[model samples]
Target chain A: MRIAFGGNQAGFWWYMAAGAVLLLAFAGIGLFRGAVPIDEGDVLAVLARHLLPGERAADPSVDTIVWSLRAPRVVVAAMVGGCLALAGAQMQGLFRNPLASPGIVGTSTGAAAGAVFALTFGLAGTFLLAAPLFAVAGALLSLLIVTRIATRDGYTPVTTLLLAGVALNALLAAFNSWLIARSWEQYEAARRIAYWMMGGVTDRGWVHVGMVLPGMVIGCAIAVWFARDLDLLLEGEEVAASLGVDIEKTKRAVLWSAAILTGSAVAVSGVVGFVGLVVPHLVRLLLGPVHRRLLPAAFLTGAWFVVGADLLARTLVAPEEVFLGVVTAFVGAPFFLFLLVRHESEVAVSR
Target chain B: MMETRGSARRAPRLELVDGGVERRGRWLLRDVDLVIEPAMLTSVVGPNGAGKSTLLRLLSGTWRLTEGKALLGGFDLSALPRRQAARRVAYVPQTVRPTFEFTVREFVTLGRYPHESRLFGTRSADRGWIDRCLDDTDVLALAERRVTTLSGGELQRVLMARCLATEAEVLLLDEPTSNLDLAHGLDLLGLARRLACEGRSVVLVLHDLNAAARFADRVAVLDGGALIAEGPPAEVLNPDLLRRVFRVEAVPLEGSTAPVFDFEPLR
Candidate 1:
C-alpha cells in the first residue's frame, strides 16, 4: 500500500524515537509528582532500588511511599492506556473505519457494567479478582451480541456494525445506571461504585498490575502476531480473501484480542474513554497504517496519553484530583466530533 | 505501449461441470458448464442479471458451487488450500474502494501474499517481481503514488499489475470496463487479450457486446442463469442470438479478425 496521508514521509524509526522520548519524558514527569513531596532524583533512586540489586534510596520511608504506593499507579495507568489504544487501532482496522474504538464498540461500557455489577452486588467480597474477571465476561458478551447483529453471510458492514455497537453501548450504560440506582441506599457502596465508574487507578497496587498486565501483554502479542493479516484486512474482507487471507479466522482472532485488551483495561480502570480513538488516529497520521508499526506505536502513544492524563488528574487540581476519565473525555470528545464532521463531509463529497 | 512477455508457465486447465449456486431458495446461477483453456480470452456476455459475475465467482472459488464440480488442473477447488487456490486463480473485482490509503506499490505487493511461504515472510521485499508486475501494467511511474489518489484509468492498470504479481494461470475479471471511459476500457480489454495470448486463461464479465466481440477469442452468452450460446465471437454473438438472449438487434461487423457490433434493444 502507498504511504497514507503523503505529508508524513517520516518513517517508523523516527516515530518510535520521537514517541519513546516523549513517553519517557511524560513518565519522568509522572514519577516526580504525588501527594508526597518527592523530587526527580528520589524517584530515580526508588526505581533503581527496585530494578537494580542492592541499590538503596537515601530515605527508606520515602522509598516505601513511592515504590509501594505511587509507582504501581503510574505503571497500571500506562498499561491500561496502551491496551485501550491498541484495541482501538485493531477495531478501526477491523471495521475499516477510523471511528471504531473500544468505547464505540461497547467493550468499555460492557466492562464497566460488569465491574459495577460486581461492586454493587457485593461480588468484590468473593475474591480479589472477581470484579475484573466479571468485566471480561461482560466485554466478550457485548462484543458477541453486537457482531452477531451486524454480520451477514460473513460480511460485516461498517454502518450496521456501528449502529449495533452504539445501541449496545447505550443499553449497557442503562444497565449500569440501574445497578447504581438499586444500590443507592447503601451510601458507601454507591459512592465507591460511582467513583470507580468515573475511572481511575488511584490506589491500584502491584496486584492490580499483575492482574491486567499478563492478559494485556498477551493480547498485544496476539495482535502483533496477526499484524500482516490485519494490514491486508484494511482493504476489506473480500479483497483480503482473494489475497489468500482466511477471512473468518482472522476476524475472530483479532476481535477476540481486541475484546481481551478492552476488557483488561476496563476491568482495572472503569470506563476510561477515547484514548483508543484518538491515539491510533494520531499515530496513523504520523507513521501510516502498517499494523506491525501501527500497533506498537499506538500502544506507546496511548500509554503516554494516559500517563500524562493521570499526572494532570492528580496535579491539575492539587489535592482535589480530577477523574481520569473526565480528563481524557475533555480532550478526546472534541477530537472525535471533529473526525465525525470530516467523515460526514467526505461522504457528502463522494456522493 | 505495453511490452508482451510470454513466459507461459504451464497454464492450468479450468473446468466447471454442471456448476450451480443457490441462495434463499433461488438459484443465482444453475448448471454453468464452461471449459476455460490456456491462450484464450473468453468474454462472458449477457444481459443484466444473467449470472456472469456469479460464474466468475464460482471459477475463482470465492463462492462455492452447490451442485456440480469445479476443478483446476484436475483437483477439486474446494479441496485446495486458499493460498494454493489463489496461486492458480487470480480475481479482479468490478470496483475496489479501499478506505485505507495504500501506495500503488504496496497494493501490487499484496498479490505476492500467496507466494510468500509459511505465512510471515515480509522481510525479503521481492522488488524484482513487484517492479516487473508494475512495469507490465505500465504503472511503474506511479509506484509511489497512493492508490486513493489515483484516477479511474490509472487505478485499473494498478489492479492489473496486482493481478500480474500473483503469477496465476487463470485470471477472472468482473466487469473490468464497467467504470471506465471509452479509451481506458479498450486499453484494459487489450491488456487482458495480450495476457490471454501469452498463454493464460482470462475470463471477463463484460456488458459491452462490441468490446467483447473485438477482443474475445470465444464469447459465452448467458440468459436467465444458464449458458445459451458458447463459441467463436461470430457464431455466439450473431444478430439472431444477440436478439434472442440479450433482447437486442445488432449490426454485426464480421469482416475483421476482431469484430465490432452495434446493438439496439428489440422492442
Candidate 2:
C-alpha cells in the first residue's frame, strides 16, 4: 500500500543513482572497448588533455581513436537513445497506453523516409542542416496526420492512432524503398540508403551530436513542463479538462515536442527501434508512472540501454560490427513480446 | 450535522438559461433552464440515458453549450478562462480509472494544480489543504494506499477528497454512489448535504429516488432531457409524477421521516 516513487523520496533517489551509475559504466565500456583496443587510462588521459589543452596522453593514436572516433559515436548514440526514450514516454502519456511509442506510431520511420529522400536526391549536398530539417518536417507532418485521423470530438482514441500509425508506417517504408530503387544507378546513394534503413551510428561525428543534443534538451524541457497535465490526462480527457488542463494545447505541445525529438534521433541514427518502447517501460516499472520522475529516469535508462547495445554490436562479432537497429531488435523484440503477454495476462486476471 | 464555516460571503450561482447540447446533428438535451443556488443540495433524478450526465458535463464546462449559455457567477461559462472556471467549480465524474498507480495522497494533490504556479513541484502551503480534505472525507487512513488497490467505496471517498481539495464553491458530482453499497451510499449523501450546509452548492445526479428525496434540499425530475418537475422533495416525490417521468408505480411507505418510494413496474 505504500507509495512507490512519489512518496518514497529516498528510494527514488537511489533508483536515479543506479541508473546514473549504469549509464556511466556503459559509456566507459563504449569509449574503452571498441574496434581499436584503447586502455582506460589512455582514454582518460586523452579526455584530460582535451580538457586542459596542454596535458598529453600516452599515445597520439589512442587520443584520435578515443576523441574523434569513439567519443562522438558514443555521445550521438546516447543522445539518440535518450531522445527516443523521452519521446516514447511522452507518447505513452498522451495516448494513456503503455503500448504507444514513437516507433510504433510511425514517427521514426517517417523521419527516416525524409532523411533518405534528402540523401538520395542530393538535397543535403554539403549541408549538414538539410537532412535534419527534412526529417523534422517529415516527422511533424506524419504526427499531424496520425493525430488528425485519430482525433474525434476533441479526443484521440488510442486504437485509432495505432491503426493510423501502422498504415502510415507501411506507406512511408514503401516510399523509402521506391526512392532507394530509383537511385540504384548511383551506387553511393544506394549504399547510403541501405545503411540508413538498417540504422547505425558508424562514423558519426560532432556534427551529428550538435544536431541532436539541442533538440533533446528542448524536447525534455517541454515534456517536464507538461508533466502534471500528463498525469491528469491519464485519468481521462474530461477529468483533465475539469482540472484546468487545456487538453488541446497540451496535446499539440506534447505531440510536436515528441516529433522533434524523434526526428532528431532518426536524423542521427536511422530508426533505432525498441529504445523508445522498452526504456520508458523499464523506467515506469522501476519508478511508478509519475512523469516528473519517469521522464528523467527514462532518459538516463534509454541512454544506457543504447550505449550498452551499441557496445555489444561493436564487440559481439569481433571484426564485423552488427547494425544498431538489428541489435536493438534482437534484444527488444523478445522484451516487447514478454510485455505484451504480461499485459494480456494482467488484463485477464483483472477481468 | 450541517455546519457553516468561515465568514459570511456570497456563494457563486450557476445558471443554465435554455441550455441545450447537440452532437452530430442529434439533440441530446434541449431547452433546459435551471438555477443552482448556494447552501443547497440539488439532486437531479432521471431514467437511464436521460442526459443527466450531459447536464453535469455542461455545468463543468467539459461539454460545449450548443444552443444556450451557462453562466457562473454572472460570467459566461464558455467565456471564462479554464483556470478561472476550475477555481469556481469542481466536478467528480461517475468513475475514473487511472492508467498509473498513484497513491491516494498523490492523486488528491492534483486538485491544487490550478492554484500552484510551478509545473512540477507543489507549494508547501498546499499540503495542509490536501491533508484537511483527506480528513474531511475520512480517507486520511488510505492516504498512502495506491488508488488502484482501493475498493470501490474507498476509491469513491478518495475521489471526493480530491474534489474537496479543489476548494471550489460549487461541487458537481455524477452518480457518486453508483458503485457504493447502501451504507456507503447513505454516508456519501450525508456528506453532500453537510457540504451544502457549509455554503457550497452541491449538485448530484442520482439514480435512487429515495436517497435523493432524503438528502436533497431540492429535487429536479428530468425525462427525455427535459425538466418535468422541480420542487422540494415533499412535493416532488408523488406517485403520479413518478409514473409520468420514470414510468413506474411508486408506493410511498408511511411512518418514515421522509417519503421513501418503492417502485414497481407500471401496469
Candidate 3:
C-alpha cells in the first residue's frame, strides 16, 4: 500500500511534467512551422533578435503565423481540451460510472441543438453572448433533466443513466437536424454549423480563451474540492452515507460543475468528442483513483492532449484543416476499444 | 479508556415508539420500550423476518421510527445528525459488495471521515488510528489488496477494521459471519467478544443460535418485531420458548457453553 501511494504520487508528477513538455513542444512546432517551414535557426534568430526588416535575417511571415494564428489556436485548444476532460472526470465521479461521457449523456447534443438554433436564427449576430449563453442553458437543462430522471427514486442506476443519455442525445440530434433543414436560406450557416459541430480551433482567438477561462476555473475548482467526496461516493450510497458523504448535496454540486465545464468547452470550440471520455480513464490507468491527485493531473494532461491534437488537426491535412473531433475519435476509439477488451474482467467485477 | 468513560456516562440506549410500522400492514414492532447497556455484547436473534434487523437499523439510526423516538447516547436518533450517530455507532450491513475496486486501506480510511477535520487532510492521529484498526482486525497485511478480490472472511475482517476506524464504542453488525467458514465465523465471534471485553458495546444479529449462545453476553429474541425474550443465553435458549417461537423440538444439552440443539427426527 505504501509503495502504491508513493508510486501514485510519482506517476502524477510524471504526467504533469510530460504534459508540460508536450505543450511546450507543440507550441514550438506551431511557432516554427510555416509556408516556408522556418527551422530552429530561424526561430532562434527571431527570438534572440527582433529580426526587423533591416535588423536580422528571419522570416516575418513565420513570426506572424506562429505568434498570431497558431498561438491563439493552441491556447484555445488547450483550454477546451482541459475543460472537456475535467468535465468528463467530474461526470464519471458524479454518476459513479466510468462509461459516462458528456457527449453520450446529451450535454454536447443539447449544446449543439442550442448553437444550431442560434446560428439559424441569427442570434449570434443579434447578441454578443447569445450563442454561448443559449448553449450553456441548453446543456444545463438537458443535464438537469437527465439527473432528475435518473435519480427519481433517490439513486441512479448505471444502465438507466446510460440509456437516458442515449435517448436524450438522439432526441436532441433530431431537433438539431430539423433546425438545419428549416434554415435552408442560411446555407452558409448550415455549413458553418456542421464545421463547428465537427470541432476545430481554426481562427480561434484570445476571446475564446477569455470566454471559457472562468467556467473552466470554477468548474475545475469545484471538481477538485469535492474530489474526496467523490472517492467516498465510488464505494456506493450506503457506504458513502456511512462515511459522512451527503450524497444529495454532492450530487447537485458535481452535476452543476460538470455542466459548466462541458458547456463552456462546447460553446467555445464546438463539440469536441471523446476528450472527456478518454482522458479521465487514461489518468486513472496511470495514477490511482484518488481525485486529489487525479483531477489536477487529468486537467494538465487534458490540456496537453487537446493542444497536441489541435496541432495534428491543423498540420495533418495541410491547407484542408481536418476536424479536431474526428482526429480525437479516430485515435481515441481504438484506444477505448482496447481498454474495453483488456478491462473486461474489471468491468465485470464492478458490475 | 475514553470510550469506557463515554459509555459509562452515556444513558442506556432506548427505543420509544407511538407507532412504528413495518413493510406489511402487520405491526411487526409496536410501541416498544427497551434500554441497552453500554460496553456489552447484545445479540438479536429470531425467526426469519422477525424485525431483528429493523430494530438494529432503528438503534443504529439508519432508519427512523415512524411515531416514536429512538435514542442513542442520549440524543434522538432522528434528530441527531448522521455524522454524530456514526461517530458513536458504527454500522455493518450484512452483505458488503463494493461496485469499484477499493483497496482495503482506502475502505478503512472512510471510517475516519467523521473524525477528520473537514478543512485539514487526515491528521496524524487519524492515520495512526486507521493503522491500528487494520492491525487489530488482522487486515494490515492485505491493506494494498482490492476489497473486491478479498474472500468473504477477509472482507469481513476489512469491514471490521473499517468499523474500528470509526472509533465508535457501539458496533452494530447485521449477520457479519453468515457467509463465512467455521474458522472465520468463530474468529469474528471471538473478535466481537474481545471488543466487548475491551468495554466496547457490540450489538450483532446472528442467525446461528449456537454462535449467539457461544459469544453474546445477552441474547434478545424478537418475534414478529417485538422483543419476546431478552436475557442470558441460558435463560433465553429454553426448549419451551424455542418450540413456541421456532416451531421446532429443540433438545438443549447441558454443560456446554454453546447451546447444542438435538431435534427429534420426524417418525
Candidate 4:
C-alpha cells in the first residue's frame, strides 16, 4: 500500500520550474494580444520605453492601451486569480474536503450579496470603498455562520459543511434576485449584476487593482503561514492534534484567510466560480499534494488560468466580451466531470 | 533534543482529586481521586459505557472535570492554554475520519507544529525526531503514500508515529488496537511496551485483557466512570472481579510462559 519514489527532488524542482515558466509565458501572451493587438516586440518596446530613457516611438493610443488599460487589468486579474486559488486551497484544507470551494461554501455568494447591497442602496460617494467593505463584512458574516453550523462538539463534518453551504447559497441567491427585481429604475443594473456574477476582468482599472491587492497579499501570507498545519488537518483533526497542532486555532485562522481572499476577489471582479475549485486540482495533478509546493503553484497557475481566460473573453468574437466565469465553466465543468470519472475508475480499480 | 530534554526536566505532574466529568446532568464518572505519575504505562480496562475514554479526555484536557479540579504539573488543566496543554499531553481519539488525503510524511510532520517557526518550516532537530518517530513505529516505508490508501492497521501505526513525533512526556491512546487484526494488535502492544520501557508515561484504553496483562506495568479499571481497581495484573485479575466487571467468567490457567485466560459465561 506504500509507494516509494526516489526522484522526488527532481520531480518537485521540475514542477516548480514548469509552473513559473507557464505563468511568465501566459502573462507575456496576455500582454501582446489586446484591443490594439500589439506584437511581442512592440509590447517589449513599450515596456523598454517606460523602463529605459530611450525615445518613445510608439503611437500614443497604443501606449495608453498597453500601459494604462490592459496592464492594470492583467495585474488585477493575476491578483484576484491568485487570491481565489489560495483561498480555495485553504478552504479545501480547513474543511478537509476536496469539494469545499469558496463558491460552494457560500463565501463568494455572500460577497456578491454585499457588493449588490451596497450598489443598490447607493452607499458610497463612488463605488470605490463602500463595495469592498460591504463585501468583506458579508464574507465574514457568512464564514461565522457556516462555521458555527458546521462545527459541533469540536468536530466539523464534511457532510455538514457542504449541506450548510448549499442552504446558504440558495438563500443568498434568492436575496440577490430579490434585490435585482426590486430595483427597476436602474434599468441596466440587472444586466450589470448578471454579468458580474458570470465574472470578468474587462474594464478593470487601477482602482480595481488597488482595492483587491491588500486583501490578496494578507490572505496569501496567512495561508502560507498555516500551510503545514493545513497539511495535517487534511489528514484529520485528531491526527493533527496528536501531532501537536492547535487544531481549533489552525481551523479558525484558515477559515478567516479563506474568507478574506474570497471576499476581496469577489469584490473586485464578482463571483468567479470554479477557478478556486478547478485550479487547485489542476495544480495538484501537475505537482503532488505537498502544501509547500501546492500553495505556490496553485497561486501562479490560477493567475495564469484567469488571465488567459480573460484574454479569451475579450478577443473570442471581437469587442463584445464573454463572461470570464462562463469561459471558466466551459473549461472547468467538463474537466470536473472527467476527474470524477477518473477518480471513480481509480477507486474501482483499488477495490 | 534540547527542547525535549527541557520539557522533560520541567514536565508537569497530573493529579485528579474527587474529580468526575458529567454530560447533560449525568455523571459519567464521579468521586475519583488519583495521581498519574510521570513515565508510566497506565492501561485502563473496562466494559462498554465505563467512561474510560472520558477520563482520558479529561486528563488530556479535552473535557472539563465537573466536580473537583485536575491539575497538570502545577497549573490547573483548565487554566492552561490549549496550545500549551497540547504540548504537555497528546491525545489520540478512538475514531478519526479524515476528509482529505495527505501523504504519510506530511501527516507525521504535523507533530512538529507547536515547535515550528512562524514561516512554516521545521528545524533539523525536529525533522530528525519526525523521521525517528516513523522509524520507531515501523512506518518509514509508508512515508510517501497517501494516508487514505493505508490499511486500518497501517493508519493506526501512522497515528502512533505522529504521537511519537510530538515527543511529549505523556502519551494517551484510546482503544489503540480496537480495529486492528491480530498481527497489528500485537505490533501495537509491542510498540507501547517499548515506549513505556523508554521512560515515557503511556496510558491506553484496551479491550483485550491478555494484551493489557502482558504489556502494561499497571492496570486501572473504570466502571460507572469511577476507578474501580488499580494495581498490578496479579492483584487486579480475579475470577470474581472479572465476573463483577465484565459479566464474563474468566478462569486463570497458570503457566510459566504467560498467564492464559479461558473466557466463558455467555455461551
Candidate 5:
C-alpha cells in the first residue's frame, strides 16, 4: 500500500515553492562561505554583474571565486541531485517498490565502474565527455543484462528483479575489484579509481556540468513523458497491459531512462549515496505517488537536498570538507529509518 | 448524455472455441467452449483449484491460449492488440491491493487510457464519461477520497467504476464480492446485473452457489480443469451435478425466481 497521507493535503503546493527558495539559499550560501569570506550581497552582486550585463563587482577576485570556482559545483550538484532523484522515482514506479533505488539495483555502481574504467584506461584524458559516455553505456548494458535475467515469458516479476539486481551488484563489485588490482601498479590510476569510489565533486569544473546536463534534461523529459504509463505500471503488469500500456515497451523505456539518469549522475558525482534512494521516497511521502507530480517534485527536492548538504559539508567542519556521500548517508539514513518505522507502525495501526 | 451513448453501446459477441491455457505440459484449463452474449450475467462456479481464474484470464485475452481460439466479433481475441481489445473487454482481478494514493476520480480516469494516446492530452476531455461511470457504480460521492482510505466494499465499487470507464462490452470480474458482507455482496451482484441489463456481457467468477443461482441468467460449472456443465442456472446447477462435482447435496428454496440452492456436504 501507499504511504499514508501525512495529514498535509496541501503539501505539494508549498513543497515546490519551498524547494526553489531553499535551493537558491543553499547555493547562495555556498557561493559566499568558502575560502574567502565574501558577503551574500557580494555574491549576488557578482551574479547580477555577470547575468544582467551590469558593472563589474567591486572585487574581481570574488567574481572569479564565485563564477569560476563555486558556481560549477552548485550547478553540477543540482543536476546530479535532480537526476538521481528522478531515477529513484522512476525505479520505484517501475519496480513497484518504495525502496528500489538505482543504487540498490547496482546501476549507479555500474556507472561509477564505467567512469573508473575510462579514467584508469586513460580514456577520460583522451576525450572530455568520455567518462559520462562510458558510464551511460555501462548503465544501459547492465540494465539490459538485469532485465534479461529477471524476465520470463515477457514478464519481469519484482522479487526476481530485485534478486537479479543484487547478483549484478556483486558481480560488478568483483569486476571493479579486479580492475583496481590491475591498476594498482600505476599509482595515478589507482587513485583515480579510488576517487570515483569516494563519490564527490570537490575540484569539479564546467566540463563536469556539461557532462551531466543531457542526462538530466533527456532523462527527465523521457521519464515525464512516460509518467502516466509509470502510474499504470505501479498497479501491476496485467493492469498496465489492460489499460493500453505496452508492458514490455514501458518497462524497457523506464529502465533505460533510470539507467541514463543514474549513469550520468554517477559519472560526475561518483556514488553519491542516498540522494537517489531517499529523496524521491521522502518526496512521495510528502506529496502523493502520482508520477507526473512526483517525478518533478522529487527532482527539486533532491536538488536542494544535495546543494544544502554540500553547504553543510563545507561549513560543518571548516578547513577540511566532508565527503558528499558521507554527509548524505549520515543525514539521510536516520531519517529514512524514521520514515520506515513510522510507516510500518502506521500500517500496523491501520490494520 | 448517458442516453445517447446507451443506444450505441451494444456489447460484441465473445466466444471461446475449445480455448484454454496450458503450462509445462499441464493444462490449467482445457477445451472450454462457451458463448457469452450481451445483456446477460454469466456466473462461473467451480470448486477451488478448478481453474475459474484461468478461464477468466483466457476470456479476457490475458493468458495466452494453448488450445483453440477465443473470438470477439468473429475475430481471434488473442490476435488483437491489447489496446483495441481493451476497448471491447475489461477484467477485474481477484485481489486489488490498493498501492497508491490516487483519488477515486483519478483512479477511474486511468480506465480511459485506451482511448487516449498523446504526450500532453487534454486532462478534462473524458470528464463526462468518468463522472457517469462514478454515478453508475454509486461511488460518485466518494470520488474525492483516496482509494487507499476506502473500505473494501467502497473500493470494490470504485473498481467497478474504473472498469465502467473503459466502456468495454465484456467485463470479467474474478470473485468481486469475496470479502464483502452479505448486503454488499448482494449489492455488488445486483450492480453486475445492471451492467448486463445495460447491454454489456458481465461474467462473474463466484464461489457462492446460491448467489449464482439467484442472480445469473446463465451459469457454467467447472471441475477437474474442464467445463462440466453449462446453461441456465436451473439446468446447470442441478442437485445431481452439485453432488457429483462439489460432493454437496443441494435443495431449492420454496419460492424464488431462480433455484436458491442450499448446499450441504454429502455424508
Candidate 6:
C-alpha cells in the first residue's frame, strides 16, 4: 500500500524540481500551440520587455497574442486546476477517503445548476458576474446543507456526509436537466447551456483569472495551514479530538474552504471534471500521504495536468476545439480504473 | 524530562459525584461515583453493555454527563478548555484504523499536539518528550516503520507510546488488550502498571477478570450502569460478587498476590 518514492526528503525535493520543470514546459505548450503560431523566443522577448522598462516590442501582434489572449487563459487554467486539486485533497483528508472530491459532495453539480439557472433566466446576460456569483452561491448552499445533514452533536460522520451528497447530487442534476429542457425552445440559450455543460477553458480572459485567483490563494493557504491537523485527523475523529484537534471546527473549516475553491474553479472553467479527482490521487500514489507534501505536490501536478489537457483540447483537431472535460476524462478514466485496482489489492494486503 | 518530573509533584485527583449519562432516552450510566487517584491502576470490569467504556468516555471529556459533574484536578471537566483538558488526560480506544500511511514516529508525535504552539513548529521540550515516550514504550526500534505495516501488538504499543507522549497525568484506555495475544496483553498491562508506578493514573477497561485481578491496584465492577463494587482487587473480586453480578462461580487459585479466578457457569 505504501509506495516508497526514493527517500522522503530527497524524493520530495526531486519531485518538486521535476514538477516545476513539467509545469513550465506545459505552460509553454499552452501559450504557443494555437491556430496562430507564436515563437517561444518571441514569447520570452515579450515577457522580458514587459518586465523591463522602455524596451521596444518585436511585434505588437505577437505581444497581444502572448499577453492579452494566451497568458490569461493559461493562468486561469493553472489557477482553476490548482484550486480544484487542492480542494480535492482537502476533501479526501476531511472524509478520510481516497475517493472523495468536489464532485463527490455535489459541489460541482450544485454550481452547474446555479450557472444553468442564471443562463436560462437571462441573469448572466444582464450582469456579467451573475453566472459566477450564482455558481458560488449554489456551491456554498449545497455545502451548508450537506454539513447540516451530516452533523450530529457537532460531529460530521463521513457516511452521513456521503449519503447526503449523493441525494443532493441527484436533486441538483435533475434541476439542471429540467432547466435545460425548459429552455430547449430557444436555440441560442440551449446552445450556451450545452456548451457550458461540456466545460472548457477557451476564451477565458484576465477577468476569469481575477475571479478565481483570490479563492485559490486563500483556500490553498488555509489548507496548508491545517495540513498537520489533517494528518492527525486521517487517523480517526476520536483520535484527532483526543490529540486536541477541535474536530468539529476543523471539519467545518476544511469543508467550507473546499467549497470556496470548487465554486470559483467551476465558475471560471464551467464544471471541468476528473482534474480534481485524478490529480490528487496521482500525487498521493507517487508521493506519500503526508498533507504537507501532498498538498503542494497535488497543486503543481494538477496545474500541469489541466494546462496539458487544455493544450491537447485546442490542438488535437486543429481549428475545432474539443471540450476540456472530454479530454481529461479520456485520459483520466483509465488511470482511475488503474487506481481502483491498485487500491483494492492494497486493502486486501493490509487486511 | 526534568520539567515533567518536577510537574509530577501535583498529581490530579479525578472524582465523579453522581455523574450520569443519558442517550436516546435511555441511561447508559447513572449515579457513578468513583475517585481516580494518581499513582494507581484502576480497572473497570463488567460484561457487555455494562457502560464501562461509557465511563471512560465521560472521564476523557468526550461525553457530557446529563446530571451531576466530574472534576479533574478540582476543575469541572466541562469548564476546562479542550486543549487544556487534553493536555491533562489522554485516552486510547480499543483500536484505530488510520486511513493514511504515517510512520510510527509521526503517529506518536501527534500526542504532542496540545503542547505545541498553533502556528510554530514543535517545541524542543515536546520533541524530547516524544522521544522519551518512544523509548519508554519500547517502540524506538519501530519508529521508522509505517504504522500500517505493524503487527497488532506493535500497533498497541505504538498507541500506548502516543498516549504517554502527551505527558498526561491520567490515561483512559478502553480495552487496550482486546485483540492482542496473551503475552502481548500481559505486556500492555505491565506497561500500565509501570505508568502507575511513575505517578500516573491509569484507568483501564478490562474484559478479562483474571488480568484485572492480576494488575489492578483497584477494581470497580459495573452492573446495569451502576457501580456494584469498588475496592481493592482482594476486596471487590470474590466468589459471591462474581456469582451475583457476573452470573458465574469463581474458583480462586491460592498462593498468588491476587487471586486468579476460573469461572464456571451458574448452571
Q: What clash count goes with each model?
A: 6, 0, 0, 5, 0, 0
Q: Interface RMSDs of all predictions?
A: 3.3, 2.2, 3.5, 3.8, 2.8, 1.7
Error of 6 at B197 (Å): 0.7
DockQ, all models: 0.51, 0.62, 0.36, 0.39, 0.52, 0.57
Model 3 segments more than 4 A misplaced: A1-8, A34-64, A103-105, A148-166, A345-351, B1-32, B223-226, B263-267
**lDDT for each residue of candidate 1 in A1-351, tens digit (9 for 90 to 100):** 222344233677677787788778777776777788877787788888888899464688888778877888888999999999999999888888776786677878888888888889888866768888889888988889988998997876666877888999899989998999999999977987988888988888899999888779779878987878877788767677777888777877788899999999989988788898998887775566767778998999999889889998999988899999999999889987877687678768866
Off by over 4 Å in 5: A1-11, A39-46, A53-61, A125-128, A181-186, B1-8
Local accuracy of candidate 6 as per-residue lDDT tens digits, A1-351: 667572275788888899889889888877766789877889888877876888565798998888878888888888888888999998888888888887678888988988999999989889988888898888989998988888887778878988999999999999999999999998888898888888888888889998998878778878877887887788888887877788878887888888989998998789788888888887877776778789998998888889888898988998999999899889988999998998889888766
DockQ of 2: 0.62
TM-score per model for chain B alone?
0.94, 0.95, 0.90, 0.91, 0.94, 0.95
TM-score of chain A of each: 0.90, 0.91, 0.86, 0.90, 0.91, 0.95
Q: Please give, for residues A225-292, the per-residue lDDT of candidate 5 as tens digits.
A: 88888888878888777767778888778888888899889988888888888998988876777776
Model 6 stretches astray by more than 4 angstroms: A152-155, B1-10, B123-125
* Full-model lDDT, candidate 4: 0.77
Judged by whole-model lDDT over C-alpha atoms, candidate 5 comes out at 0.84
- Which candidate should be chosen as best, given DockQ against the real structure? 2
Candidate 5, true inter-chain contacts retained = 0.55
Better of 3 and 4 by DockQ: 4
I-RMSD for candidate 4: 3.8
Residue-level lDDT tens digits of model 3 in A1-351: 112333245766777888889878876776667444657775776655543455665567765655556667878888888888888887777667777776656888888788888988888877867777778878888888887788865766545767888899999999988988887777887787888788878888767778888988889878877888888777666666765667777877877788888888898788888899898877766666667777887788788888878778878878678899898988888998988887886567645
lDDT (C-alpha, whole model) for all candidates? 0.83, 0.84, 0.77, 0.77, 0.84, 0.85
Q: Please report the candidate that would top TM-score against the real structure.
A: 6
Q: Candidate 4 has which clashing residue pairs, if any?
A: A243-B111, B12-B73, B13-B73, B39-B201, B40-B201
Candidate 1, clashing residue pairs? A1-B102, A1-B103, A1-B106, A1-B107, A2-B102, A2-B103
- Tens digit per residue, CA lDDT, model 2, A89-187: 998988887778866677888898899889899877777677777887788788888999989877776668788989999999899889988999998
Backbone clash pairs for candidate 2 read none
Candidate 4, residue A349: lDDT = 93
